[model samples]
Target: MTMYSTDTPVNGQDQEVPPFGTAPIPGSRGEEKRAHLQARRTEDRADRREAAEERRRDREHKRRMKTEAKNAKVGLALQKKAERQKLRAKRRKERAGRLVELREKLSHHMPLWGLPVVLVSLAVGASGQADAALAAGMGWASGGVPILTEGMTLTLAGLTAQAIEQRRPHGWLMRATWATATGAAAINAAGHYIAGVEDGADKALYRAVLYAGASMLGLVLWWIVMRSKRAAISGRSAEETTRWKRLARRHPVLVRRARRVVDNTGLSLPEAYAMVWQRANGAAPGEPSIREIRASRRAAFKRTQAEAWDGRTRFSRTAPAPAVVVPAAVEPEPETVPELASEAAPELIPAPYLPVALAVPGLDGQWIAHRVPVHPLPAWRPCQEPGSETATTRFPQGQEPLPDPSPDASEDEDGTQPDEAQEQVREQVADDRLDKARALVEQAALEGRNLRRHPSNRQMARHLGCRPGTAREYLTQVLAERGIRR
Candidate 1:
């Protein structure tokens, strides 16, 4: 609130000077100043809000990129999982196909299997009536009885053992028993039907039906026996079954036997010898795995044969040629004619070791080729060093001495046997050298020193002719003697 008086003197002479008044606040003389301040603050706040908004937009953009990256990672994982599933499905399909193929092979082989079952059933029936025929057939098929004796027995035993350990079902014995029973019943029924009675037709029909059923039942019984036995041994349950060993013990010694037969012998006269060995062993469920084992053994046998062959055995069998008529040749003009000048060529002469000799022995000149048999070291064994016993009886006598290698032809031969004598001297020198090496390390070690604690153990080993590990050991021993921590 300001008042001005005409009579008031201000600053000096009154002169009706305007009342002395404080200068009005710049725009706020009425309220404009306060408004200006408020405007300024408002503008500042607006600028800050815009800056914060910009920052928030930047953060949102960064967040979206992070989210997109996460989504991509998840999608890639899913795609990989799908690919893995596809691969597994493909594998499953391949395995299924292979199993089917194996099954098909088995079906074709079933005929071969059927022969034995039928033959066996007939033999069993004949044993009661046609003994001679039974014996003959048995002798022919089994070479008396059983085939592929020991090997087949062993393989089957191994399979059974593995089956027991792995805990699995085996269809082999079951299927075999079933077939045998069916075969036996059919044979019995046929035999009865053939031996017709007074009520011939009705009796024949009845006998045939009964025999077939009996044969089928026989097969079922066989399976029951086998399965029960397996279950007993495997500690499972089917029906009470006895072990083969116990049965063998209870039966006549002559009839007692193992029941395994695997055979892969070829149908040759010589294979008869092999068949003889087959009867003394055991029996398996079906055709023995003899063929596979034989194939493997045959290859090994061939390798041995080839080794024995050298140049003396390997040969190509050629067929004899039929005779042909020859016609006389007419001479041609010198310019157009070509002649084989074999006049200077020598007839092919075979080497003394060669099965067939040739003049142009090899690809080039008739080179003096020598066939040196290098017996390779056995793969299963390590190299036998000097002083070891050789397996062969006719090897070089006494222990073979270690090979004495000289430094080089570095010896001054002097027309004397320098190499041998020098080798002896080197051996002697080496013996003394170790002693000198010991002296150096011994001194270092006395100083309570360890190469390991210092710069290098290799340096110490270099001073010794042995290895770094050895040097460290020696140094450690020395430290132990000195009773030092180093």
Candidate 2:
């Protein structure tokens, strides 16, 4: 059996071809080409992979560098903040220490100087007291002499200081301190004088002065210190003392009363003074307190309420009279008219038209009361013609009817009719008022006020001190005289 392979000769070379369903031969040209192509793809993929790896590494490196830079900046900011906080803390501690030192110095400076003066006084006083006691023949009790003098003085002063510090009443304690201090100073001077009498008169005098000054110096210093401490505690400065002194001088009586109040009530001077002032000036003898006023108001309100509850009405409840209706143009027969009762008759009261004295500014700038006549409207009456049908009006009791208006009316003693004289006076007053109004308008115009516009009735009335209607009339006449239109 002859088995043939898929090989053919081409150009005098044997060409190996892969079978239809089999792989290519190991050393064939197709295998070599496929290998070359695969190798090219693998090299391309490896190059692309290396480029991607390099880019990833670069991104990581940049990210790490950025993170490190941010951390460094944060650490630097934190370091600066810590340094600032440390500096502030150090400054605060130093300031606190300085304040404490200042306070300690201020509080102790007085005692620091006072202690040395006290020690010197104690030594000098003890020597003086021992010598005095020895001269008095008290052998064993010579040491007790200083105890009675300087020791007693110091003890009393200390007690007085304690009383002042505690805000207790220390009047007697202060007096005792002064008495003991004076006695101790006297004793010290006497003892020194006795001891130096044998030396000479001048030596004795000098010893007395030295011993006395030494003994009193400590007491004086102590008194000053206590006074300063008391003033500080009570908030009474030199200015406050001067102010109180001035007030006391100004109001001695008030100060006396305030002192009494302070004694009785244990209140501060200001509080007591205020109390005394209120008692003296808040109200007069007849003036009531606010409590009394409120009580009176409440009583008045209760009385009013009681009156209301008892049906005691404030206004009258009586019915009004019926109205009389008269026709405008109708005439009634007198015999057919109903007669009105005495109680039902309406009184005819006239309007007030009396002459009033108006206070007006005169030429001298002083107010002068000028008499002005007020003209009233005339009363209306029925026609008194003969054969006229009109009802006669009734008059109230004890009243007279109006007189007839006729030319034959009586005249006054001055040879003039009363009505005529009244009319003339009214006209004269109107002329005077018109003149005053004109003067005022001219003055206003001269003062650069607009004269084209006239003042209103209220303003004119206020200026002229007259009624609005009268002022209006004066304004019209003044405007007419000036030739100004309405």
lDDT of 2 by residue, 1-486 (tens): 673332335655544444457776558796687557666877988999999999999999999999999999999999999999999999999999999887665343246656888878878878887888888899999989898787787778777877887878778898998888777777778888999999998999899889988887877887788778888888877877777787788789988878867866799888787676656656322344344444444555555558756443559585455578886986875777677758767767664322444454332224666443332434434575553143433332343444333466787688877556655655666666677788888887788876666566666776766778878888877877778756
Query: Poorest 10 consecutive residues of model 2 by lDDT?
Result: 388-397
The TM-score, computed over Cα atoms with residue i paired to residue i, of candidate 1 is 0.22
lDDT of 1 by residue, 258-314 (tens): 221122223432233234324322312222234433444455556666786535323
Best by lDDT: 2
Clashing pairs in 2: none
lDDT of 2: 0.71
C-alpha lDDT score of every prediction, in listed order? 0.47, 0.71
